[model samples]
Target chain A: MASVTFDHVVKRYTSDLTVVKDFNVEVADKEFMVLVGPSGCGKSTALRMLAGLESISEGQIRIGDRVINNIAAKDRDIAMVFQSYALYPHMSVYDNMAFPLQMQHMKKAEIDKRVKSASSSLGLGNFLDRKPRALSGGQRQRVALGRAIVRNPQVFLLDEPLSNLDAKLRAQTRIELQKLHRDLGTTFIYVTHDQVEAMTMGDRIAIMNAGILQQVGTPGDIYDHPANIFVAGFVGTPTMNFVAATVQDGVATASGFHVKLPKALPAAKGILGFRPEAVTDRIPDPDSAMEMKVDVVERLGSDQFLYGKVGGDSVTARVDPRIKVEPGDSIKLGLDTRTLHFFDSETELALL
Target chain B: MSVVSPATKPGSPATKPVNLERRSLLSAIRPSRAILNIVLVVSAVFWLVPTIGLAIISLRPESLFQQSGWWTALTAPSQLTLSNYQTLFAQGLVARGVLDSLITSLEITVPATLLVTIISSLTAYSLVFGRWPGRSVVFLVIVGLLVVPIQVALIPVVQEYRVFGDLSGFNPFGTIPGVVIFHVAFGLPFGIFLMYNFYSGIPKEMLEAGRIDGAGEWQLFRRVALPLGLPAAASLMIFQFIWVWNDLLVALIFLGNNKHATLTIFLFEQTRTLAANYWIISTGAMISIFIPLIVFFSFQRYFVRGVLAGAVK
Candidate 1:
């Protein structure tokens, strides 16, 4: 019923190298929090530490009211689903799902009831008697989820659980997982490298990089108001475009164009950031926006993306699919001044 | 395991006569197949000659064994009799020796095999999964013990066992437990080395997943590690079982004419006299071969090539 608090948790292997550095976040009760990052960002390490699989090197990790830094994993009242599913190969689906409960010495009837209910929830009711080897990848994943769900743990720690599933299944499971989270209303902390999963599933997403917490916010907040250049680049699909710019007064100037900046901005010189959608193709006057040399045009049904260069810096624009322009074409692109972000050139922190 | 074969449809081109091109290709390999089969059958018979000879000698009369080769029974079929077996039973010395030896061998082999499997699995589990200091050194030392010949340790072990026996007022030398203890100690190093390699091949995430799923150290070992380790444990069981079963030197040295005689000791006693009892020896040898084959086949199913398949993907 209580939240998880990670207070300046530092996982340092040596004095110089730290895999996780001062990671601090308080996951709310019954909230689905996702720690999203690229590979080697220590997201898995953070989750493992919380799960008591890895020891926290420094600082305290408290679940509910007790500090569990020294507690054994089994006593931590948490369950996990793994990327590889990690199903007990020798056990049948029912036995695999019931193992933790059976370890707790629950009555056989109760375990069977729980296993049956959990399996039915995951749509694996018909395959209870089958071994993990006889199941498909998606089925195995559901079994793993069912195993964790049967525990009815205080916290559900998932380390890229849906990563091994195919795209369609991953998407379907993403929705079902969100629904399962709502149904159980238990604290779920999911870790994944996929931003789409984090964006779709997390109540609040924490973006991490190189062992440091970059930003923690709602998906929209992170996408709209990224705390740094890393979060900005990491959170988006096509990635936010960053051009070398010089901040004169409050306006950020890039290439040969002068773009208006949002009022009350942090005064910084260097990189200017804007999403692909922030730059428009149609504008009355050309000098008001950036001018680009069109390079490659990618046309989808609903959207067309233009990959091009403004001066020497490469920029991408998401335009209407009807706009037809081949490579090596010069085009006038207008900047959405309201959404422009200026970042410090040296530290890459957000200026606006 | 069922393999798919081509199906011939009525209206398809497959209904036509076989093409000469494919027919010749198929037939040329056929003559070689007959020759290969003949060679295989001949070689099988050639290799089995000694076992067949032993069987015949065990069933022939003692005078016949002394008078002619075992192949003589094939030419003079009527000369075959069960007199050797009757004589073996009537004397009762070989029977008691064989039974004693079997009990002794089983006493040594079962525990030795079991101890090696349990100890190796525990050691391998810790070496692969546990976070401790100098595990690699410990593992390396265990593997290093593999090269140390059992003969090198026999004198010292005997001396130590003698000292231990004196302290406890119960001697271990020329005892069944001593023989079993010696075999277990010597068999452990290779067993641990083998199981360690195997356990290391399992993905670390599975164990981590187990830990997060609320499985403690013992529970993780019992539930996750041990079940997954069956293939390794089975092979190790077979290896240790056969090794201890076939062992004569360690038993001969440590168990020295003890009342609890192993099969090897029983076999050795037949050759002890000036006139070796070939009839008893052959019968006893065949009986000794019987148990190992059974043990091998029992564990043969676990020798599956890919137990780890379909586990991850």
Candidate 2:
């Protein structure tokens, strides 16, 4: 197992079309570093460049102590599981897993031992003789994983490997992948557009937007303190609500409410950000609470969500499922002031 | 109809009994299906008539073949014998020519088909997956070559062969290898065109997966792209095999009617000089048809519908 480092990496397709700019990350040994972003955000491009599948336009990537920019993909000694579980359809599962070993010209007995152990670990022991077409989607995904695991390379790269599975399978595979990572203790560079996967899986998540690195932190760190407005909005479910507000003296004012800041800020205009959970149905202090005119209520059995308007701006709130609420009902909700965030309107960078 | 109509409604107590009776009635006399089957059989028989006629003519005695049409022997079954086949085989020189022609055809067709399939597959793999510069331009040139007629290149290629002989001390003008080379040249454009389109359909992720699995370029082509391209390769072999096998023009021009004549050239020579050598012509045609028929039928299984199913989600 080895740590991976991308130092000042840039992926410029053409003079005017640079996709990833000055990408830099230092993944520690045995770290599960996830690169997450929306489509066209160049997260996958960064992973591809590190994989050596794509040529880096500038800078250097090193695995352990070896610089890899001039190396071929096969020579890089990294295995990648594609978003498409690209199992060799003509070969049986055994051969699929044994392919890398065969390429290494390893002894036959050792290859068999590795393939058998990997297949069994993947719960694919019975499927060793079956072709890829005979396996289900989840099984095919496991075979892809098995193929990588058999190689036992210094690092494992997975590009949205669980995206092809059904929802239930995706959930199950996500946990299994985490367990596999723990078992292997290999440095893994995983890329995905799904924030939930990032939050649940990564030892550290690096969020990117428009080819620029937004933030790199532990999931809890990122969730509690996103560096910019984009990370704040993109990292959360139901997303963080951003309300345009103006600060005067120590008070911040918006359309339907005003709150006193803990400390005074020089910025006259800023955006207030808060998670849905921070807006609760019970108001701890009526004076600080704002009235939300509920437009739609979704009861998800365990947790209910209220989508509504607060002073002509849309807001979503996570509320108690037992509480009886309906659309067009006006309700009072409290903001957890300590959990609230503020970003400058001009820079969109976090102010607190 | 009346009974079935009442059962069409939901929760009707009469549904099951009427459904079973209607199904049995429909099965007993399905007129539309019957008409479709009859039409299919008629078309199949219409396709087979010429082949069956050739078979019968090949079986008829040479005297009877000249005296009457094959239909006459079909009615009088006793007159239809294997005598024509026997006579053609019994003539020592004719037998030698047939044997030599068969060998020559095999020598030309097998290499040509194998070379075209292998070269086209490799070229298509590179075109689709290789990261080299000018790949698109090279592919476009190959596709452009598809439109240049083989007839146009015939004279120029023969002159070029003579020039090559002058420079290299080896002329390809009237040899088996000469015919094989010509066939491979003319066959490659379409072969690459077909295989390139097919290879393009294979998910790019598949090749990427191979690369990450530590496969080099040659390994990727051999282990991933080639296996996935089997259906296209199989069909290409069948096409190139039949085209070179039955080619009279290329063989006649490049491999002149000396000793190294292909089956088609030999058959053509029989009909060209001895116009009345119907027995030899019919028998030789059947022999030539026999090889390609075996080839097509043997490799027909590779024309499988979903070879790439479940390759990717």
lDDT tens digits, residue span A302-349, model 2: 989999988977888999999999898999998777787889988999
Q: Which candidate is the best by TM-score?
A: 2
Candidate 2's docking class is: medium
lDDT of 1 by residue, B53-114 (tens): 98888777777777889898998888878776565556554534666567778888999899
RMSD of each: 4.3, 3.0
Measured by TM-score, how close is model 2 to the native structure?
0.94
Write down the C-alpha DockQ for each prediction: 0.60, 0.78
Off by over 4 Å in 2: B1-35, B92-96
Instruction: Write model 1 residue lDDT over A196-309, tens digit each, in one string.
Output: 999999999999999999999999999999999999999887899999987766677777577767665545568989999987786644555777799899888888889999
